[model samples]
Target: MKQYCQSILIFFLGLNLAFAQNKTENVFIITTDGFRWQEMFGGVDTTILKDDKFVRNRDRIKNAFVGKTAEESRKKLMPFMWDTVAKEGQLYGNRWAGNKVNVMNPYWFSYPGYNEILSGYADDSINSNDKMYNKNITVLEFLNKQPKLKGKVAAYSTWDVFPYIINDKRSGIPVNSGKDLVQGNLTEKEQMLNEILKNYPSLASDRHDFITYYLAKEYIQKNKPKVFFLSFDETDEFAHEAKYDEYLFAANTADKFIGDLWSYCQSTTEYKGKTTFLILTDHGRGDKIKSQWTSHGQKVSDCYQIWMAAIGPDTPALGEVKTEGQLFQNQIAKTAAKLLGYEFDNGKPVGREINSVKN
Candidate 1:
C-alpha cells in the first residue's frame, strides 16, 4: 500500500508539470501591412505577373516568384507559412476553401484595421490614416497594466503612425516606429542601426522593414518582453507603387524574417517552448479586378478580406483550416490576451476570443 501511494503521488506530480509546461507565457503579434490573401493563398497572380504595367522585369519576377501552378507559386512566395505554419499550426482566410477572416471595421484601410485588431473595437471616428492618438485602449496597454507584464510589452512598426495607433504616449508602451525609434543606452548594434537610419532614404514616412526588424530583434534579445508586436510595411508600400516585383520580393523576405524570429525564440532559454506567434495582415487589398490589388480602402472591393495564422506550444497542429468558418480581425486582441492566461476586459465589448487558435 505504501509503494502504491508513492507511485500515485509521482504520477500526479508529473501530470501537473506537463500541464504547466503546456501553458503559453509569451505571445508575438506580427503583421505584414496590407498583404492580400490572394497572393498568400494562390501565390503569384499570373495575370499581374504577365502585365507589363506591373512586372517591369518579367525575367526576375518569373525566376523568383512564379511557379507553373498557383499552389507552387504561393509555396515559393511564403514558404514559412505554407511549409511550416500550415504544417505545424493553423491558417485562416483561404477563401478558396471558404475559411474566411475579415476586419470588423467598416473602413478597410490601415488605421481602422489596426485599431480593430489591437483594440477589439472598431470606432468609426478612427476613419483615416492620420497621426491621431487612438481613443481606444489596446490589448498591449491592458497587458502592460497587468502586475506581471508592466514594462514587458513592446511594439515596433515600419510606419510612422504606430505611435498614434498604439497610443504609446498614454499607454506608456515603448513603441519604436519610423523617425521616432530607439534612443539612449545604445548597444553597438543599435548605434550602427541609428547611423543607418540617418542616411537611409525615406519612403513615405515608412522606415525600411529591415531596419525595424533589426531594432526589434535587438530589443527582443535584451528585454524578453511578455508581449511583442512587430509590424512590417514594405509589402503595402511596394504594392501601392504598382511594383509587383518589389511586392513579391518584400513578401518573400518577410517570410524569412518571421522564420528567423521563431528560430531565435526556440533557441533562447527564456523564450523557448513558451512563445506563441500570431501572424496576420492589418488589412486586405482588392481581389477580383486585378488592378484593384494595388489599392486597399473602403472604396476598394474585397479589401476587407484578410488572413491570419497562429503557431505555438498551446495551438494544436491543425494546419490550414479547410472547414467553412468566419473570423474577424477584432478577435485577435482577445485571442492574444487569452493565450497569456488573461481575459482582457476594460469596460468595453472586446471581440470574443478565438478559441480555435489554441488548446
Candidate 2:
C-alpha cells in the first residue's frame, strides 16, 4: 500500500509538470442519456409513440407524424447545434460512416454503460439494480488529482447519481442538479427560466436528472471551468416513461441546449477556439421491435449501438469516415486524460483518438 501511494504521488508530479509546459485547453464532455442514432439521423415518426415493450399508441400511430427530416428538424430545433458548430464540428452518427457498437449484452442499461465509459473496464461485479455511488475511480476523479488541472474541472448532471458517478464529495468540484440554486445575478432569460421553474411543480422535484445542460451553461459563463462534464437525463427519463412523443421532444430540447451551449462558448472569449466539445450517450435502446421504450439489458444488437461527436480546435470539418480501429467506452477516460494531459491508474492506452485532434 505504501508503495502504491508513492507511485501515485510520482505519477501526479509528472502530470503537473506536463500541464505546466503545455497550453491550457478546455475540454467539455457532454452526454445525452439513452440517445440513439436513429433519432439523431432518421427523424422520428410524430405519430407512433411506443414503449420499450413494443406497445404502441395506436391512435397516435394511426395519425402518423410526417415530421421534418432529422437533419432539417435538427437545424430547426437546434439552429446553433446544426448550423454554427456543426459546420466546423462533427456529429458521430455520421462522422464515422458505418461506425456502431460491437453488440448488446446484459449490461445495456445506464449504470453499466456509465461504468464502462468512465472506469476503463466494465465491472461484472456490479449486478445490483441500485444507483451507483461507489465501485470505481471515475475519469473526473482521476483527472482532479492532477495539480495542473487545479480548479479547472467540474461536473454537472441532471441525474441524481451524478454525485456518485463523479463522487462529488471525494472529487470536490461543484455539482448542481435536481434542485434549482442559481448562484449569480439572473439575466432576463435566466430570470424567466427561474419563473418557469418556480411556476411548474413537475420540473422541480421529480427526482429526474435532466437539467445539467442549463446549469452547466450558466456555470460556464460564471466559473469557466477548463474541463466540464455535462450530463442530460431527459431522453432516458422519457424513454422509461414510454412516452415516445415526449422522448422526441426531450431530444429536441437536448439539441437546443447543446446548441445554446455551443453558441455561448463561441461568444465567450475563454472558450471560443480553445474549447473542444464531445457528445455521446452512456447506452442506447433496444431494437424497435423490442419496444419504443420497453426493454434493454439483455444482449440486443440495437442496445449496444451508440453515437459520438466532437467539435472544436482539434476536430476535423464536417465529413464522414470510419473510426480507424476498435473503440470502446473505456477509451473515453484515456482520451480525456490525454487531452487534459493528466495521468491515471489505468495505464492502458486509449483505443484511438478521434481523428484530426492536434497533439
Candidate 3:
C-alpha cells in the first residue's frame, strides 16, 4: 500500500512540473547602443548623406540607402523590421507622429541609459561609463533569482562594461562580453565561432556585433535560457567615429540579426509560442543639422529620445503607436517582467508596465 501511494504522489508531482514548464514564458531583450529613432522609422537621413563632412562617397551612400521616398529607403535598410515587426508587432518613438519615448537618466550616455532600461529607474549618481558595479538591482537579476529562471538567464554584449552594469559576479548569471573567450561545453559550430573570433582582425576595441549575436544564439540553443539580453555596440562606435556609412550599414545588419532571432524563436518548440522580444536602444544622438549627430550627452539636444518595439504572444500587433503620450525608458524593465509572468519589484518606486503590451 505504501509503494502504491508513493507511485501516486510521483505521478501528481510530474503533472505539476509539466504544468510549470508549459506556463514558463521567455523574454529576450535586445538593445542597439545609441541608435536613433529617426533612422529607425524614417530610414537613412538624406541630409546627412549629402553632407561631405559626414559622408565620404555621397553617390555610394545615395545608391545604398536613399530611395525615391523615406518609406522605401527605410524598408531597403531594415526590411525585416519595417516589413515583419511593423506588421506583426508594435513600434513607438516616432516624434513626428507625436509618439515619444525618452530615457529618464539625466546623463544621456551608455551606462546611465542602460541602467534606466534594466533597473526600472534612473540613478543620478551613475553619470559616467565607469567600471563601477551597479548598486541597484536590475530586472535581469530579479528574474535570475526566480525559482524557474535561476541559472537559466544569460547576457551577451559587445561592450565590456556589461559585466559591471549587470553585476554578473553578484547575480551569478553567465555574461559573455567583450573579447572574453567563450566558456563551457560548446557545440561544434560554436567552437568554430570561437576559433574564428580569435583569428578575426580587430575591427573595434570591443568584440564585433556578429560575434556577440552568434555567441548568444549558440548559448540559447545549448542552454535554452528562460531570459536573455543581447547588446550590440557597432552603431554607437561607428557613429562616434563619424563614419556615417558604416553606421547605416551596421544598423541594417543589426535589423537582420533581430529578424533572424525572431525566426529562430518561432521555429523552436520551447520558444515557438512562448517567447517575447523587446527591442530598443539606449539613447539617441544629436540632430544632423546641428552637426552634432555623432554625439550624445547632457548638452546634446534630443539626446534623451529613444525608441522601443515589442513582438510576442502577449503584445498586440498595433504597429507604430502614434498616441500623444510619452513613454520613458525605465518602463521597459517592468514591461519585460510582466510579459514573463513575474512582478519586477526592486523595493523602490519605478515606472509602470506599458499599457499597450499588457494583454
Give the C-alpha lDDT of model 1: 0.90
Candidate 2 clash pair list: 47-65, 51-293, 51-294, 52-293, 52-294, 53-294, 54-291, 158-209, 159-209
Among the numbered candidates, top TM-score falls to 1
Clashes (backbone N, CA, C under 3 Å), per candidate, total: 1, 9, 0
Instruction: Evaluate model 2: give its TM-score.
Output: 0.76
User: Candidate 1 vs candidate 3: which has greater lDDT?
Assistant: 1
Regarding TM-score, does 2 or 3 come out ahead?
A: 3
lDDT of each: 0.90, 0.63, 0.88
Q: C-alpha displacement of 6 in model 2, angstroms?
A: 32
Total clashing pairs in model 2: 9
- lDDT tens digits, residue span 264-311, model 2: 877888987777777778877765664543445665456777776667
- Residue 231's lDDT within candidate 3 is 95
Q: Which candidate would rank higher by TM-score, 1 or 3?
A: 1
Off by over 4 Å in 3: 1-24
Model 3 residue 260 CA deviation in Å: 0.4
